[model samples]
Target: ILAGYYILGFSIYSSILLAGLFASQTLIAYPIVNKLGIARDKAVTIAVGGTVITDTLALLLLTVIVGMATGNVDDTFWWRLGISVLVCILIIVVLFPIIAHWFFKLCSDNVSQYIFVLAMVFLGAFLAQLAGLEPIIGAFLSGLALNRLIPKTSPLMNRIEFVGNAIFIPFFLIGVGMLIDYRAFFRDWESLEVAAVMIALITVAKFIAAWLTQKSFRLSKDQRTVIFGLSSAHVAATLAAVMVGYNVILGHTPDGEPIRLLSESVLNGTILMILATCIVSTFATQRGAHNIAVKNALQTNDEEKSRPEEHILIPVANEQSVDELVGLSATIKRAKEPNGLYALHAIDNRVDDPNMEKRARKLLDGAAKTAAAGDLYLQQLLRYDVNIANAIVSTVRERNITDIVLGMHQRTPGSTALPAIPGIPGIPGTSGPGIGKMVTDVLSQSNVTTFIYSPAQPLSTIKRHLVIVPPGAEKEAGFQMWLQRIRQLARNTGAKVAFFASDATLQHIRPRRERKAPANIGFVPFDRWDDLPSLEHDLRDDDCLWFVMSRRDRVSYHPAMSRIPGYLEQVFAGYSAVLVYPVQAGATDRYL
Candidate 1:
C-alpha cells in the first residue's frame, strides 16, 4: 500500500501513513461469520491471525518512519524500539494469559470476571504506552491472551460482546464519524479523486492478498471472499494513524505555508475509504458465508450415508420461552451431530430502541445456556428487520435450516377456551394471531419441516407420542421427512409412537416402520379423517399429541382437521402437543 501510494506521487511520510492505515483493518465481519457458523473455521482463524501479523508489521514500520522523520532515529531509538516491542510481546503473550487463566479459575462471579477483563485491557494499553508503542496493540494482544479463558458460548462471552458491540463500539464509531470533514469533499472536490484512488488501491491490494492466501492455503472461493471482506474494513487503527499524521507538519510549502502531510482532503478521503470498504466488506462476507454454508451442507449430505445430520433452527421471541424452545431442540436433535441446534432471535427493527439488540443477545444467551445444560451446542443467530418472517426465511435458506421449532403464541392457553373461528386454510386456531401469522408465512414460504411445539408440561416426562395423520398426509412430500424427525424424537425419548391414520396411510408407512422402527411405532386405523375429535378421549397426561398436517396449497391438506389446535386446547389441554408442518415444496432436506 505504501509503495502504491508513493508511486502515485504521495510524499514518503504520507505514503507510509496510508500504508499503516490500510494495513490495520477492523474485524467488522466477525459478527456475521459468528452467526454463519464459520467463526471457528480454519480460514477465519487464519484471516484473524493474519490481521495481527500485518498490523504489527505496519505499526512497526510507522514507528520507524516517524522516528526518522522526527530526527530521532539514533542507535538509542533502535535499542528502545526493539526492546520495547519484545518486552510488550513477552508481557502480553506470556504473562497476561497465565494471570488471566489463574484469575478466571479463581473468580466464580461473572461480574467480577467482566470487570477483570476490562482492567486487563486497560492494563495492556498502559503497558504498551510505557513500552513506547500504541495502546491499541496492547489491547489487541490482551484480547488474544484472554481469548481461551472466555468460551464463545459462555455467558461471560455474551456479556462482553453485548457491552462492547452495543455500547462502546457504537460510541467509538460515532466519534470516528464526527471526525470526518464532510465539507472537505465539497470545498475541495479533488478529495473525491483521492478517495477513489485510495479505495481502489486498498480494495485491490486486499483482494490480491486474500486470493494469494486462498491459493496458498487451499481455501475455497467463499472462504477467500470472507477473508477479503473481514480484512478490508479500515476503522480504529486507520483513523488513529491518519489523525496522528494530520497533526504532523512534514515541512513548509514553496510559498512558506505550513504543509500538513495529511490534509483535510486526505483525511476526508480516508473516511470515505473506511465507509466504502465497510459496506463492501459486510455484504461480501454475508454473501460468501451463505455460499460456503450451502456448499458445506451439500458436501455433508453426500458424506452422511450412515446417520443424517439434522440442523434444527429454533426461532425464539419470548425470553421466558427460550429454555423450552432450546431444550426441546436439544432433546430432539441428533446426539451424534456436532453443533446441531441453531437459536435465532429476530429483533423487530420498527421498535426503535437502541438496547433491543442487547436485550436480544441476553435472550439468546439464555437459550444457549439452556442448550449447554443439556450438553448441546447452540449456534446463536441475531437479526434486525421489520419483517421477521422474511428475515427468518432468508436465514433458513442461507444457513440451510432443515427443521424449524417454534413456540406457541402467548394467547394460546387462554384462547383455547374461545370457540374456534375459521383461521388460515391449514392452521388450527384463529386465537394465536402472532404465532399463526409467523407459522403461516414460514411454512408456506420456506422449504423445511416445522414443528410448532406447545409445551403443556415437561417434555421429558411424556412417554407416548400420539400422531394424528390428516387423510392424504402420507402422500405429501414432507410426510417421510416429519416421520423421520418424529422417529428420532421417539427413539431418543424411548417413547411409544401411536399413529392414527387411514388403512392406506398405515400401509404406506408399514414398510418404513418395519425397516426403521417396528418396535417403537404402532399404527391404528381411523377410517374417517374427521374422527380426530374422538381421539381426545384416549389422550393421557403422558401423551404428546402430534398433528402431522400439510401445507395449505398441498394435495394432502384437510379442511376437517383445521380444528386440530382447538381440539388440543379444548379437550387435550392437559397434555403437551406438537403441530407438524411438512417441509415446503422444493426445500432442501439435508439440514433438517
Candidate 2:
C-alpha cells in the first residue's frame, strides 16, 4: 500500500499510513481454507506464515513512521524499540510453548485446556503491547509456538476452531460492519474515489505477490487463486492500523489543528473494500479447493496419482481380535502410500459406566501396539456416541477412509431378534444384535469398501484366498475399488486368488485383470448366480472365504441375500470369512 501511494506521488506520511493500514488484515478466510481440507497445502501455508511476518514488520514500520513524523526519531527511540522486540520474541517463541506443553500435560480435562489457551492469547497480547508492537503479532507467535503440540485432528483443535468461527470471529466482522456509516459515503463522492483507488492498489499488489509466489513455488493455478484470495481480505490488523492513524497521526492538520486524518468518505470506502475482498476470498477458495479435489479424483489410474494413500480403519471391539484385524489391514494396505491404519473404538454415549473411555483407550492402545510390532504406523480414534455405528460412519467420512476392516460379530443372548418380515428385499431373518448390528449399519450407511473378517484360525496360517462375486456384483459402483483391493491383498500375501463369478461378471473381470494386471488373479466361472450356495463344497480349512456382497437396493442385491447372516452362522461358523462391500455408485464426492 505504501509503495502504491508513494508511486502515485502521495506525501511520505500518507504513503506510510496507508502501508500500515494495509498490513492489518482480518484473515477472515482462514475457516474457508480449513473447510477445503487444503489448510496444510503449500500455497495456503505460505500465505498464513507470511501474515506473521507482514503484520510484525508493518507494526514496526508504523512506529518508525510515527517517530519520524513526530520528531522522536532518536538513538533512545531505536534502543527502546530493539530491546522491546527482542524481549517479546524471547517470551513468545521460547517460553510460551514450554509453559503450554507443561500445562496441557498436567490437565486432562478439555475445559482447562481451552481456558489455558485463551488465557495465553490475552497474555501474548498484553506482552506485545508492552513491547511497542501490535498485540496481534504476539498472538501470531504464540499460535506458531503451540502449533506442533496440537494435532489438527485432535478435539482441542476442533474446539478452538469452533469457538473462533462460531462466536468471536462473527462478532468481530459485525463490529467491522457497524463501523461503516453509509451516510458518510452518501454525503461525499470523494469517499467513493478513495475507496476505488485504494481497493485497486491493494487488490493488484496482492495478485502480483501471489503470482510471483506461484511462479517461484511451481504451484498450480488453483493454488495461486487460493493464495491471492487469502491475502486480499483486510480486517483486524487493517482496522487497528487505521484507527491508530486516524486518532494519533492522520488526525492532525499541517498547521497542527486537530481534525480527522481519515475523512468519513475514506473510512466508509475502506469498509466497503473489506466487504468486497472478503466475498471474493470466500468464493475463490471454495472454487479452488473443489478443483483440487476433482483433479485428484480424475487421475487416469491409481498408479498415476502421487503414490496412492490408503486410509484403512480397523474398528476394534475386542482385545482378542485386535492383532488379527491390524495384521489384515497392514497386509492389504498399499505399500507405497505414506498413511497407516487407524484403530477406532466407538463406545455408546448412553453408557453410564465411567470406565468406558478408559477401557476404550486401553483397547486402542492394544491395537496400536499390535500395529507397531508389525512395524506399521497406527492412529487411534476413540469416540463416545449414542450410536456406535453412526460414530464409525462419521469417522469414515472425516478420515476419508478407503477401506474398513472389522471383526465378524455374533449375536448376543440378550440382543434383539431379526425382524420376522425383514425391512428390505433379499435377506430374511438375517439380522442380529451387538457386533452384527454395528457391521450391518456401517455396511448399509457408508460408501467406503468394508471388510468383515472372522478368523477361525490365525490369519498367518491361511494358505489360499477364495473370492466370491455374486451375480450382478460387477454392476456395483465400487466393484473396481474392491477388486483392486483383492488384487493388492493377493499380491501382498503371495497367495493365489481363486475368483468365482457368473459368466457375465467374468467379462468385466478379464479386462480389469489385463488393465490392472493384478498378481495371481484367476477367474472360475459359475454358470448360475443362484448356485452361490454350492461354493461350500470348495471351501476348506486352509481357504479364507471372501464374499463380495452388495448393500440392499444396490444393483447386485438379491432377495435371498438377507439369508447371508443366518447362512454364515449355520454353515461357516468355524471358518474364517470376509464380507466385502464395494464402493457405492455416484458417491465420488467423498472419495478423497
Candidate 3:
C-alpha cells in the first residue's frame, strides 16, 4: 500500500514540477544571462542550451514510466543505460566538435547555421538513445559544440529563438498546468511532507553548488551573491531531469506500478522546489544587479544639457545648384543670429541605372563643401530602396528637425494628366510637390514648421512687403514670433509692411448693439473689396503683400471668391501677395 502511494504521488509531483521547471527556465535565464554582461545573442544561446536538456530528460522519464507499468525493470537495462551515457559523452566531446567545424565552413548564411545546429542536436540525441544513454547529455554536448561554431550575432539564431519563446515555450507551460491535480496535495499529509523535504534538499544542494563554484573562482562578494542567488533557481532542466529519471531510468512493475515506488512523491517535491527557487532567485538577483548598475550609471553623468531652439531641416538634392543652394545658404546667413539650419540629402536607390551612385556622390560632395565653407552643420543620409516620403519623415523625427525645405525642382506641383501640346518640355517626371505634401502632413500630426521655396525666385533680401490677414479670433501666442522674424527680415532689407482685414462682408450681417475692436492692433474694416479705393493706391506703393494665414473658425471662401482666375491675376487686380502661414514656434506639424 505504501509503495503504491509513493509511486502515485511521485508521478503526479514529477508532472507538475517538470512543467514548472521549463517555464521558469526561460524566465530566470533571460535576466541572469543579461546580468552577466553578455550580449543579447550570447545570452539567448546560453538559455537555449540550458532548456535543451529538459526535453531529453522528459523523454527519458516517460520511458522509465512505461517500463514500470509493464514490470520490465532489469539489470541489463541499467548496464545498457550506463553504456549509452558513456557513448554519448565520447561522441559529444570528441566527434561533435570535428563535425561542427566542418559544417560551419560549408555555409555562410544565417538559415544554414540554424539547420546545422538543429541537425547536430538530433544526431546527438539519436546516438545517445542507440547507446542506451540519457539523450539530454547528448543534447547539451551538441549545444556546447555548436556554440563554438556559431557566431553570437547570427540573424538565424535570433529568428529561431524569438519564434520558440513567442510560441512553443508558453504553450508547453500552460499545457503542463492543465495536467496538474491540485486536490492531491491537500488529501495526503505524509506525501506533502515528503515533497517539502525534497524541495528543501534541492534548494540547499543548489545553493551549495553555487557557493562552491564562486569560491573556487575567487569571485568578489557581490558577484558570488548574485551567482548563488541566480543559480538556486531550478527551471526546466531540473524538472525535466527528474521526470526522465522516474519514467525511463526506472520502469514500472508487473502489477502496472511505476518501477520506482517513490516516483510521484519525488516529482511533487521537485515541483515545489522549482517554484520556490525560481521566484526567490529571479527577484533577488535582478533587483540587486539592477540597483548596482543604476547607481554606477548615475555617478558617471558628465554631458551638458542642450538649449531648446527651433530647428529647420532642409533636404537638398544638389548643393551645387547655385540658384537654390546658394540662395538658401545666403538666406540662413543673413537671418538673425542663433538660428538653426540642417541641410539633408537622401541617396535614393530606386533607379536601376548604374550612374545613380555617381550622381548621388557628386551631389553629396557639393553639399559637404558648401556646409564646410559656411561653417554650418549638414546631415547626409543614404537610403537604399526605401519610400522617399517615409525616409524624409523618419529622418525628420530622428534628427528632431522642426522645419523642412526642399529644392524647388522637388517641390513643384505636377499636373494630374499630360498636356495635349507636343514637344513642350514635358513636366519633369520627377517634379512634384510631394515634399510639400509630406511637410503639410507632418505639420498636422506634429508642430513642425515648413518652408517651400521656388528655385527660380529665391529670396535674397527681406525688403519684401508684409501682409497680415487676421481671422478675427483671439490672437495666437505665436503671432509675436512670426512678427519678429518678419520685422527682422524687413530691418535687414529696407522693406515696407501693410496689414489688411476683411470688413466689406461684415455689414451684410445684422448689426449688433455694440462693436468691440481687437486690443493692441488697429484695423480699418470695409464693406467690400471695391469699397476700399485706397487698396489699389496702397498696392502701387508697396513692392509685395505678405499675407499671414492663421487657423480660425470663421475663414471660409465664398463662391464668388472660388472662381477668381489665378493667384497672379487676383494680385494684379490690386496688390502682389506673398502669403505667409503663421505656425507656433518650434511646433512640429505632420502635413502628410
Candidate 4:
C-alpha cells in the first residue's frame, strides 16, 4: 500500500489491490528444489506452509476489495463471507471425497477417470463463484482433494502431472505475454518507473519476510534463501488481482473517460516484475538445493556405513502372489542396493509330476518381471530337494539371507481354511491343511525374519496400515531391523501407521518413530490380543493389517497369535494383511 500511494498516488482501493497482488506468490522455482530431491527438507516445507497462508490472505483481500467496489462492504458481508467459506469447505473436503470414491470404485476406465477429475475441477470453480472466491483457488482445492485419494507413484497422478507441466504451465506463460504490452513500456516513462519501483519493493518485501521467518524459527541461511526464492515469483494470482482491479471502474474522468482502479501501465509493469523475479528466484533456489543435496548425501553415506548389508530372499510358491510379495520386498529394500532381491522356487524332487518344473520356471519368470519394473535385480535360484521346507531353510543359510517373504499357507484350490474346526481343536488356525505343515516347519527350522503375506487387495491402493505389535516385541533380536524396515515402508508408500501395542513397547517405539518419520504415525495403547475380533469396525478396504507375530519358543510369543491364520483366512480375509515373524536369538540359521 505504501509503494502504491507513494509511487503513483493511487486511491485507497487501488492501493489495496496492488498490495494484495504483492501479497500472493506462485512457486515457480519449486521444480528446482524438487528435482534436487530436497523438496522435503524442513526449510522447503516451511516455505510451503507460508505460501498456503499468504495465498489465502491475498485471495481474501481480493474478495473484500471486490465487495467494497460494488458497495457491499458491511458487517453482514463479513458474516456471509465466513459462512460461505464454511459451506465451500464442507462441500469440497467432506462431500467431494465420498462422491469421487464412489465414482472411482464403480468406474475402471482410465480415460473416464481423467474426465471425471477434470469435471470436478470445474465444479469446484462453480462452487467458488457462489462463495465469492476465484476459480484458480477452487481448482487448487480440487487438486488438493485428489492428492489424498491418489498416491505419487500412481499412474493417474503421473499423467496429471505430465499434462499440467507440459500444457498448463506453458499456456499460463503465454497468457502472461498476452497481458504485457511491450510498446507501452517503450513509449511511457511511467511504465518503466512503475516496473523499477514495483520490482525493488517486492524483492525487498519478500526477502524481509523470509529473513524474519528464519530468525523467528532459527533456520539456516541456505534455508532462508530457499524460502525467499520460492516465495518471490508473483505470477498467477498477482495477474488475477491486476486484471480484476483494472476492470473495476468507480467513476469517470473529466474528459468523458472511465476512471479505472488501475491504469494499463501498472499491468504492463507487473509482467516485467514477473520476469525479473522468476529469474532471480531460479538462481537462488538452485544454490539452496545444491547445498541441501550435498548435506543429505553425507548423511546417507554415514547411515549406510552403520546399517548391515541387506539381502532379502522371497520364497515363491504361488505364481499369482509372486508380484505382491516381491513388491513388498521392494518397498523395504534400500534403493542403493542392487541384486538385493532373490526369488527362490524349491522343486519338490519327491513328487513325480511332469508339469511341476515348468510351473516353477513360470513363477520365477513372473517374479523377475515384477522386480525389474521396480528397478531391482531378482536373482532366480532353483533348488531341487526332497523336503520343500528344508529346501527353503537350506537356501537361507547358503545365501546368508536376513529376511524372507512367503505366501500364507500356500493357498489350496478350494480351501477356505477357517479356524476352530470341529475335528482340529487345538489352535486350529495355526495350520489349515496341505501347506500349513511346510510353513510351520520353515518357521521352526529357520530363525530369519519371515513375512507371511495374505493380500486381499492391491498393495498400491492401501492408504493406511494397522500394526499390532506384541507385548515383548521390543526384546526380540530383530527388533531394530524390523523397525528400520517399517520406517522405510512408511517413507516409500507415504501411508500412515497406527501401532497398537502395550505401553512398554510403545515407549520403546516412540523414540525411533520421532527420529525417523515423526509424522503420520500414531501410538495406541492396546494389549488385548484376545479381543482381536473387535477391530472389525476400524478395518477399511484401503487399510493394510500388520501383525508382528513371534516364534512359539521366543520371548514375545503369545497363545493368541495362533488365531492369525484363522483371521487372515476367514475374518480379515477381505483385507491385505502381513504377519511378521522377527528373527529370534539363538534360533537363526539352525541348520547351519
Candidate 5:
C-alpha cells in the first residue's frame, strides 16, 4: 500500500513539464512587456503575478475534483458543504485580525516580512484543516492578506516572495506533475476533452477577472489589454491544485483499480494544459514588453555617440622608489586606453616619520602628472592611521578600482651595493620586510587584479632568452600571467621562450612540453640538479635565461634552498655563463 501510494504520489508530483512551461512563458513574456512600454521591473512583476494565479486555480479545481472522485460530494450534502465553507469563513474572520495585528507588530521594523508571510501561510493551512477545508485555500488567502499588509518596496517582502518563487513554487509544480501519468492522456480521448474544458474555463475566468479588475482600477485601454495578456500565465499554483485534487480530494482507485472520478488521464491532461497556457502567456507578454522598450529607446534624443568611460581607482603605496613608481604609473596609464584613472594614496599612521604624509603626497602628485600626460585621468587621495595593505584593499573595494599595479622591491640581505647579498635575520642574505612577499600575500586575499612590477632585463636589449621553468602547481596563476606577458614581450623583441618543469611537475605541464622546444619556445623537464648542465648546454646558444620563480618554497630555488649550500652553489654555477635573469624588481632591473 505504501509502495502504491509512493507511485501515485510520484506520478502526481512530477513537474518537469511544468518547469518547461514556465520557462517558455518567461521567454514569451519578455518581448510583450518590451512592446508595452512597461519598465523591466514592472514587466517581471506582471509576469510573476500572472504565473502565481495558476496556483490558486489549481487548488480550487482540485477541491472540486476530489469531492467527485471520493463520492464525498454526496456524503457532504449541499447544506453541509455550505456550512463547512461558512465555518471556514468564520475561522478566517476571527483569526485575521489577530494575525494581522501580530504581523504588523512583528514587522514593525519592516525587517521580518519573510517570517511574517511564512507564519501567515502556515497559520492559514492549520486553520483550514481545523475548519475542514483545503489547506491550500487557507494558504492562498494567507498570501493574499500578507501581500496586502506588506509594503511593495519592503526588502523583507521581496525576499519572502523570491523564496516562494525559487523554492515552494517549483516544488509545488514538480509535485503536481509527478502525480499524473502522462501516458494515460495518449490512450484516452476523454482526457483531451477534459483538458480542453478546463483550459476554456480557466481562460474565461481569468479574462473576466482581468476585465473587472481593470474597470475597477479605471486603467487605460492599453493597460487593460496588457494586464489581460499577462493574467493568462499559469504554472506553479495550478500544478499544486491539480496534485491535491488528484491525490487528496479525489480518492485514488480502490484495490488498485482505475477510478473514473480521479483517473490518471485527468492529471496528464492538466499537465498539458499548464504547459500550453504558460507558453501562450509568456510569448504574449514578452512581445508586448519588448515592443514598448524599443519604442522608448527610439524616441530618446540623440546624444554623443561615445562618452568617456568612467575612471577606476588604483591605489599606490608611498614606499616605492621613484623609478618603480613611475613604471607602474606608466603601465596603468597605458592600460586605461579610453578610460580615465584615479590614483589613490593611503597615509599609514603607523609610520611615525613627520615627513611621511608630505612625501606620500609628493610621490602621488608626480605619479598623477605622469599618468595625466599619457591621456589618463589621475586622482590622488591620502588616508590616515590605517594599515597600508588593508587601506589599499579597502580603497580598491570602496572606489571600485579595476586593477592594481604595484611595485614590489625584493628584500635582499646585506650590502646596498650591487652583487652584495642582503642578509636576512632568519635566512642568509635576505633582510627587511620583503615587498614581493607582501605584494604576493596581498594578491592572494584581493579580488582586484594585481600586476607586480619586478626588476628584469630590458626588453629591447634582451634577445633569444628562455622563459625558464614551466609553471609549478603552486605558482600557476602568477606564472601563467608572467608567461603570457613574456610571450608578448618576446614577440615584440623577436626573442625565444624556454620552459622548464621539475620532474614532479612534469605531468602537470601543459601548453609546453619538455625537451622538444617549439620553434620560438623550448621546454625542459628536469629533476636532479646535475641535469642543469645538459639543460644549460641546450640553452647555450640563447642570450639570456628568464627564470620564472615559483612563489612557494617548494619550487623556489632561493632562501628556502639556501640551507643546502652545495646544491645551491651547483645550481648557481650551472647558469654562471648565461646572463641569469632573476625576477627583476623594476624596469631598470630589467634593463640592467
Candidate 6:
C-alpha cells in the first residue's frame, strides 16, 4: 500500500489492493530446487513457509477489496465474511487432515490415492466457495493440511509432483500467459511504465525481506539468495488480486464508461511483472541450489572420510519376510552408503541334504529382488555353516558389518518361533533352545549393533514408533547412530517417534536430536523399565515397538534385557517389534 500510494500516486483503495497483489508469491522456481535435490534444504523450506502464510493473508485481503468494490461493505457483510472464513478454515485445517489420513490408511491403491488427493483439492476449493471465499484460498490450505502425510522422497509424493509439474502446472501457466497482451508493451507507454514500476517494487521488496531474514538469522549468503529467489516470483495470488480488481467495476466515468478498481494498464503491467519475476527467480534458484548442493556434497564427503562407512546386514530365511527385512535394512542404512548393505542366507549343515543349500541360496535371491525393487544394492551372501548365527557372526567379521537386522518368526509361549536359525545349539533359555539361543548367541558375541525384528505388518502402514530407551542407553557407542536411524525411519514412514526414557537419558537424547531431528519426535519421561508390561494398553495396531537394549556387560544392560524375548513371545506377539542392541563406542574388548 505504501509503495502504491507514494510511488504510483494511487487512491487508498487502489493502493491497498495493489499491495496485496505483491505480498503473496508463488513457488515458480521450486522445480529448479527440486531438480537439484536440494528441496529439503533450510533456505528452500523457509521460502515455502513464507509463501503459504503470505498468500493466505493476501488472498483474504484481496477478497475484502473485491467485496467493497462490489458495494458490499456493510456491517453485516463484515460479520458474514468473518464467520464464513472462520468456518472455512476450521473445516479444512481441522477436518481435512483427519479425513486424508483415514483415507490413506484404509486404501493402498496408488491410482485410487492419486485420484483421492486430486479430488480433495477440488473439494477444498468448492468448500471455500461455500464459505464465500476464493476457491484458490481453500486449495492452498488443503496443500498445507496434507503436506506431512506424504513424504517428499516417497513414490506417492513423486507421482503427485510429477503430474502437477507435467500437466496441471504447465496448463495453468499457459492460461495465465494468454492473459498478457504483447502489443500493450510495444504500443502503449503507460503500460510500459506501469510494468517497469511493478517489477521494480516486487523485486526490491522481496530482496529486502530475504536480506533482513538472513541478517537476523545469520544464514549463509547462498541461502539468502535462495530465499530471495523463491519468494520473488509474483504469480497465483498476484494474478488473482489483479484480475479481481480489474473485473470489479466501482463507479461510472464521466464518459459513461465503467471505472474498474484497477485500470487496463495496471493489469497489463501485472502480467509483465509476473514474467520478469519468474525469469529472475528461475535463474537465482538454479544458482543458489547448485551452490548449496555442492557445499553439502563436500561436507558429506568430509564426514564420511572421518568415520567408518555405515554398513547394515540383513539375514533373510522366510520367503514371506524377505521384503520386510530388506525394508528395515534400508531404513537403517544411510542413503549415500549403498554398497554397505548385505543380505545373507545361512545354510544349516546339520540337515546334510544338498537340497538344503539350494533352498538357502533361493532365499537370498528373493532378498536381492526385494532390494532391487527399492533401487537399492544388496550383495547377496549364501554361506554354508553349521549354525545360522555362526554364519551371520562370521560374515560380520569378514565384511566389517556394523549393524545386523535378524528377522524373527511369530511365537507362542514355550514355542520355538524363529525358523530362520531354527534348532540352533546354544545356552538353554526359557523360550527353549532354538530361536532364543540363536538370538542370544548373535547378541552375546557380536560387538556390532544387532536388531532383532519381527514385523507384523508393512513398514508403510506404521503410524507411530513407541521406543523404550533404557536408563543408560545414551552411554552406548551406537546411541547416536541408532537414534539417527530411528529418525530416518520416522521420516520415510511419515510416522512420529515417541521416546519413553528417564529425565537423565532424555537430557542426552534432546541435544543429539536437536542437531538434526524431525519436528514430530517427542520425549516422555518413564524411569521405570518395569512399567514395560503396561505398554499393552498403548500398543495400537499401527504402532511399531522399539526396545533399546544393551549387551551383558554395559551400564545400560539390566535384568529386563533377559526377559524381552519372553515378552515378545507372549505380550507383543502380533505387533511389529525391534530389540536394538547397540555396540559400545570405542571399547576394543569383545563382550564374550
TM-score of each: 0.53, 0.54, 0.42, 0.82, 0.38, 0.80
RMSD of 6: 5.5
Rank order (by TM-score, best first) = 4, 6, 2, 1, 3, 5
List where candidate 5 sits over 4 angstroms from the true fold. 1-113, 185-225, 244-256, 293-592
**Which candidate tops lDDT?**
4
Model 3 per-residue lDDT tens digits across residues 1-592: 2222353344553444333333333235454545443212222333344345444554455445445444676878767766767767787878887776555444434466667777888888687767654465466568666553332222344455666779867886675465345676887765477656655654665567556755776644444445545555665556556655555434556787756533555566566666677677777566545654554446534311222355656665654352245334333232323235555555556667657666666666666554443334455555553545566677767777644555433323554532222222432221113223554444445444344443323232222353434443124434444444444443333234444555642322212322322122233453333232234555442244444443322233122221111222333333434333345533433433
On TM-score, the stronger of 2 and 4 is: 4
Where is the poorest 10-residue window by lDDT in model 2? 419-428
Provide the lDDT at 86 for model 6.
96
TM-score of 3: 0.42
User: Per-residue error at 323 for model 6, in Å?
Assistant: 5.7
lDDT of 4 by residue, 216-319 (tens): 98988889899999999888888888888778887888898888878888888889999999998898888878887887889788777877788899989887
Worst 10 residues of 3 by lDDT: 557-566
**How does model 6 fare in lDDT?**
0.79
- Distance from true position, residue 31, model 2, in Å? 2.7
By TM-score, the best candidate is 4
Q: Per-residue lDDT of 1-592 in model 2, one digit per residue for the tens?
A: 4453554445667567776766655556777766555565678778887877787787788777766766778879999999999999899888997788667645645577778888888899889989888787778778877765553433466588778879998898899888887887778676677777778878888889989999999999999988888888887777776666566543556888765444455567678888777887778777876787567557645664634468899998888788778767866775434356899998887788878888888999988876654446799998888787888889988998888999888666776666543443433376334237677677667788889888766554455788878888877878878877876676555556788888888888775436344436778987544544566888876678888877666788766556665566665566678888788775333333
lDDT per residue (tens digit) for residues 1-592 in model 6: 8877887777788999998888889998988887676877778889998998899889888888888768778989888989999998998988998888788767755578789888888988998888877789888889888776765444457688778989988998899889988887778698888889899988999999999989987889999999999999988889988988898888898998988889888899998899999999998888888999999888678765765777789988788777777878876666545567898988877677888778877888877766665556789888889897799889988998888898864444785434332232332234333236677677666778778788876665667888999988887878877887887776566678899999999988785437455577888898777646678887787788999987666778776666666667666767888988787754335533
- Residue-pair clash count for candidate 2: 11
In candidate 6, which residue pairs get closer than 3 Å at backbone N, Cα or C atoms, i.e. clash? 477-585
Ranking by lDDT: 4, 6, 1, 2, 5, 3
**Model 3: lDDT of residue 549:** 41
Alpha carbon deviation, residue 514, candidate 5 (Å)? 80
Residue 51 error, candidate 1, Å: 0.6
How many residue-pair clashes does candidate 3 contain?
55
Model 3: how far is 7 from its true place, Å?
A: 17
